[model samples]
Target: MQHLMLVPVLLPLLVAALMMLLGEERHRLKMALNVGSCAALLAVSCLLLLRASHDGAPQAVGVYLPGNWQAPFGIVLALDRLCALMLVLTSLVALAAALFACARWHRVGVHFHVLFQLQLMGLAGAFLTADLFNLFVFFEVTLAASYGLLLHGSGRARVLSGMHYIAINLAASALLLIGVSMLYGITGTLNMADLAQHIPTLRASDRGLLHAAAGILATAFLIKAAVWPLNFWLVPAYSAATAPVAALFALMTKLGVYSILRLWSLLFGDEAGASAQFGSLWLIGAGMLTMAFGAIGMMGSQRLGHLAGYAALLSSGTVLAVAGFGQNLLTAAMLYYLPASTLAISALFLLGDVMDRWRSPVDGADPYEPTSEAAPFLNARLEPTRGFNLDEEEQALVGRPIPAATAFVGLAFLLCTLMLSGLPPLPGFVGKFAMLNALFNPLGLAASAGAQPGLTGWVFVLVLIASGFLALTALVRAGIAHFWTAQGRGPLRVGLAEGVPIGALLLSCVLLTVAAGPALRYAQATADALHAPSGYVQSILGAEPVPSVAAGSTLDETAEATP
Candidate 1:
């Protein structure tokens, strides 16, 4: 029963390895395997979620110790409501991405299926690992896979932006190593649960060292999360990537947020003496600045991909700011917002790709292909293909009515816009409303009188409302400029495979809106579990009999223990 925890991680590893063994021409077979693996992953993730949240246990959390070794020594994988929710979300988006990529993206680059699966593996491992070292390992794995995916099409722009992406993350990785090593040296254990137990007992003299370690670690995560000053690389890097890859990359920033929530709640939540709520003010302040910057960027963006990039930053900032509040209700709301925003943004990335196709003038040549001798360098920016001509003669011609397919695409774009901007009648609005209600309700901190969030809460409220307005204004302008006022030389050619994924994603948003009650309740439960870590720690270090390992510890400990 406990072994089910390993499937999400191992299944992707197996699929990626098998795909690597196949020839490039075996595209159909590779896709078949990819789809099958994703289906299996979704199934297993659902089972894990159900098991973790089962009514009978109420306190149910699964901890799998690799090699039957005890905690603080061996690799451990812990499954709880939060982990399960993340797994299920990752698999769903992955399935959608796979289906969408089938149209042409999978073939655009070599080893797409392998890298995709590897990326999934890395995401799952990051969510499941119960220690700092493995967290760093999984972070590297995900980033390595993402580097390949970002450069999948290998155009000059892609390569250039990919180089910047690589250098930035490499620096982040070094910081992560330093932070993890510092913690391990102090705690005598890399296991997260053990670290939590040890943090409160550290001497006052060593507290400064711990803070330094945490600050370094958070700098790395903030970079990945695209928080303000450190987030300069995100827009170009994401905007330059191919559509499917960008869609998958939507969750990359969320991973950073997850790490923040997980570590902060576990290690610093009312447990660590002087370190409780450490750096939270910084989180809130930085998050607000990020949102402000994202809003301005969204308004000024020239391309749909860049607009989507700014939208992502806005979403990340909102969640980060709310998370900084440290209230259970705010955390619950953030959980709900996490999935809602992730799905909406991912759909936007996919939908943005199609919309770009519609607006762009047809060009026979690949815009992304490397052309210059210096294309391999880190700072090159290739010229993009020109779309519609705006010359007076071209504009003077009578415009054709929007085609039926084009109208449908526009409708899809509108829906995506509504969701991303938190417009009414969409899940985005609901998530934000829930968050605000949590912040300002009578039972809430600021509204209860004498709470610290008095001014801060209102600032958050104003920023949230203002960001949505900016999104609406920007999206409306883009929609009108592209779809209402202009027409391409020919009708946009959209196929069934291409349209299905977009429709499905939009439909899911609608369903999320309709079912907001149940969704919010589940998110609340997940947050409840997160804020109280005793149950999780007990599951990992206090309870249960160790399983028997079939073989002696002769192989690589982590690899052999994984299953």
Candidate 2:
């Protein structure tokens, strides 16, 4: 049971390392290895999620202390319902991306499978780690893998975007290290459970330093979260990547939101004496502003990639703001919204890639060229003639006309737009309704707290409504331009490989809507666990009580003594 907690992190690391040693000529072997690994990961994640959710309270948290060292003394990996859920989501997306890439994108670069595995490893580690230091480490690992993947194809636009992405993240990384150091200096431990226990005991003066460190750390995380002002780099970087890469990148922003939600609730949520609700106002205010920014950006976006990027920002803002509310119902709704929205955006990205390719000219003619034309066209290569050849006289016949793949593209596009824009009959609308109901009903936050939502909360509501409206307007406009107003360049060929992943993603959203009751119940349980983190702390710390002396000791002295 304990060993399973480490599998998510170690399995990917081992696969990535093994892939690195394989030869470039072994493409088929590489593809098989990648698919097999992703399938195994998905299977393991599902089992872990089932165990975490079904097992009894204490048993639900599976904690592994490496080197047989105790908590706060060695690296600890903990898997609870929340971590298991994230692992499942990560593996699902990863598997989809891996399958989609195998269609053709894998040939664009060396080490594609290796880098992909490394990225998954990092994401899993980030979600499961019990210590702040390891979180930073995992962040670096993920970012490094992304940096390589961003420039995999090696084009001018990709290079330019990758440069900006790398530079900004490197700066954020520096801040992360500095903030972690400061927190360690003040609290004497890097374990999240330990930090939560120690924070309430800090002196007033030390609390000021702790707040400053937290502020720096939040800045780094918000940058990754794609929060306003700090998120200028996300649109360009994401918009320029290859389709499969962009789809995987959809989960990157969620990682930041996950970190903020987890750490904020554990360390500061009405628990840290002087620091209780320390940054709630900032979170709500910044999140609302980010939502507004994304809405505006979506309205102005001319490219499909940019529209998807802005949509991601909007999703992040919604989660961040709901998290700020500190209401269990809102958090539950946000949890449901997270995976639903991510899968939708990922499908959109994949669809965009196919659209881009379908519209592209092959040999200065329609990409879907006629197969039976009698003209022996010099550039007659198309989907049907991948490896075969024809004599000049025999190839001189006119190509056979085939129906365009427009139906699949248009239908998928409509579904994705509906999901992204929160239209009725989709999971997006259900999640939004759940959130709005929680916000306005008499039994909700306002009535229970004996207070109105105030100007800010109301503003959040207005922004939420307005963002959805803007998204709808933008998607409608884009849809009409691409599908209704435009003439078909040629008949597009949608391959089974490409169509399957998109369909799976859309189907998942439908399932989410169908199963909303049970899904939301699970989300509610997750929100409860987050808000009341005593169970989380106790799970990590085990039967022994937290050491009081550790709370007062200086981290520098502790560091010196440990070595």
Candidate 3:
């Protein structure tokens, strides 16, 4: 049982290494290993998720005492509900992306599986590690893997853009090191479980310094997340990368948001009220601006790649806004938006690739003069009379059609739109309903009470409504043209491998919609547990939060209860 936790982290690293041995020369071996590894990873993470939901406790795996040390001195890789759940989602998405990349496996070659496995290991390690230094180590591992993937199909654009991506993250690495070093210097500990208790005890001056370190650390996170002003690099980096690579980048933004939420739960609980008053306001404002910027960019865009890229930016805004808003809704939003946005963006990217491959001519003529009209796979070529040419009337009636594969890609974009726009019957709409429930009701306004938002909920309501309205308009305009209008171009047959992953994604969305009630209950449980993180400290370090009152002012007297 103790070692069950290691399965998610170890399996990918092992499989990736195994794949490296197989190499690209044996195509079947590479495919088998990739598919098997991901399947195993997904299965393990799901088991972990089940354990978390049932047990409702951090699963401990004291894997190695290395010199038989225990407590903070010994390393720990714990699986709690939040981390385990994230692992499940991460593995699922990574598996889908890996499977999708199979079509172009030959093009990607030897480096493909190596980088893919490393990326998953990094993500798993990040979620599991209890040590701060270990977090940095895993972060770099992830980055290194990502760098290779980014430049897998190298071109001038990827080369130049990948350089910027590396350089910026390197700078972030330095900052993270500094913050962790300062934190260790002050607390004399590197374990996250230990720091939670020690952080509130530092001298006022040290607290200020800690906050500064947090800010610097947040810079790295924000930069990665593509939050507003720092997001200048995201569009180019994401748009230029291959479809699967772009799909992985979709989750990177969430990493930053997750870290922030994790840190803030420790730093800014009701004990300080500091996290809420100052932190929430700042992020809420930034999120609003980011949503505006992304919306405007999407509205002005023409290319499918750029459109999807900007759409990623818009999803990042939702993360910030939800985090800033706080309460049960934050987790709920994360749950809904993550899968929704990933499917949406990924589907669109795959479609874009298809469009570029089979684009019809724009000169009012049929480029596919001889082609399989109804059954593409049945023939290599058709008679000149068999295919088609689009005249003016026909063109107008069908409207502009993307290439065969690209048309289906629109489903991903539609999913993304539903997520961003909070359309009905989708998980995003459920998330929106839950958020508004918390916002207006505040203090568990549902059949149950939620945390009191105080005045922040009011601010959140206004901001969300305003940005949401614009996003709605933008998406409606963007999608109506593609989905509602006729596709004048002839339909092309899609292969099973390509269609299956997307079908799975859509199927997942449907399940999420149908199961939203239970999901919300789970999120509420998650929120309740997170909001009171004493269990985390106790479970990991066998310690708990002990309040210390200021000499002159009693905490209760100074306190503003958020509930």
Candidate 4:
């Protein structure tokens, strides 16, 4: 149990290294390894979450020090309710994406399994690491893997989009490094717990530099979160990538949100004296703008892929705004919304590929627009085929059955549309309602004298409602064009690999809806833990190094030397 914290990072690192030793021709072995590793990761993440949530435990937070070094001096990894939840979410998405990729996408490129495992390693590390410097290291690892994954298919459009994606992320990485340097120069420690401790005691002269450094650091996170003005690259690049890659990229955006939530709450909570709640209003404003931009983009998008991309942007905006509010209940609701929206959007990405293939041109003509002569049942006249009679073609179509694949695709699309639009009875609607409830009654009890929502709250309500409407309209239009008007098409041959993963994701959404009570309770606990981070701080900083095993040395003697 003590070593479990290391498995999320080490397991993937070891697996990827082993896979790298195998030749590219051994795809079956690679696929098996990828799926097996993802499953193991999901299992480990669940165990961590349970451990973090146990009520009987003295402390739910677990901190690990590599080489048994003390905190603020050597690397630290901490697991609490919030980080544990994120780990579970990351593992779930990765597993589904890996299963879907095994159908065909993995074969399209080289080193895919290796990169996939490395990507998981980075994500796990980013969520677990408790310092600024190692966060940057894990960020690079994740980005490096994503770069190769984005260009896996190697097309002209992918090349162009990949270049843009690479350039922007590289710039963000540079900003991150600079910010880390400035922060270290000012505070003299990079551990987040240590920084939080040092922030309140800083000299008056250093406050300005601290804020500047924090702002630069935030810009990098915002860029990755796809906030407005910095997110123009998201739709084009995401829509151009292959299906499975785009699905995995959904979690990548949320990683930025997680970073902001983790750092901001720890460093700027009520304990920060004059710096408490700094830049929060800016976060709210940016979030609103991002939501509006994403909603408008969704309404105007033509392709399903583009719509899915915009939907991801909209989801990011919603969570960012909610997090900025700094209210415990609102953050809890956003936590529920986060995973639900991510899973639905990922399903949309995978479904879009099948729909696109389903609508491909057959025999150089529109499959849905047959001549009226072929169907004299219609009250219109049209030219007939030169070699075949209209009556014979119509007779040939009389008993043809609708394909099972078509039905499955249409049904899956409908469910995705409902979930994304936040319609009733789905987890999406439950999440939104929870947010609205929390916004109006922030204390989670009867309304008090000054409990009314402010102007920004009302504006956020309007944006949330309007975005759902726009998303519904756009998806309905796409559905009508694809499913309703089609008359004659061949059966789509969906592989079992593809169908099963989609089913599993959608079923998970259903389970969330059914079990909203416990899920919300967990989310509330996570939110509470985040806002009151003393436990997190103490767990990391107060942890002692393991005593050395040198001969003839007392345990106290080995532990007495301070790092």
> What's the TM-score of each model vs. the native?
0.89, 0.88, 0.83, 0.91
Local distance difference test, per candidate?
A: 0.83, 0.86, 0.69, 0.87
Name the regions of candidate 3 deviating beyond 4 angstroms.
56-68, 272-278, 360-413, 443-456, 476-493, 543-563
User: Taking the tens digit of each residue's C-alpha lDDT, what string does model 4 give over 254-373?
Assistant: 999999999998998767878888888888888888988988998999788999999999999999988887777888899998999999999999999888877775444433344667
lDDT of the structure predicted as candidate 1: 0.83
Poorest lDDT segment (10 consecutive residues) of candidate 2: 393-402
lDDT comparison, 3 vs 4, better candidate: 4
Q: Is candidate 2 or candidate 3 better by lDDT?
A: 2
Candidate 1 per-residue lDDT, tens place, 458-538, comes to 898899899999998998988888777775434577777677777777787888889888888888888777767777887
Best by TM-score: 4
Clashes of each: 1, 15, 3, 0
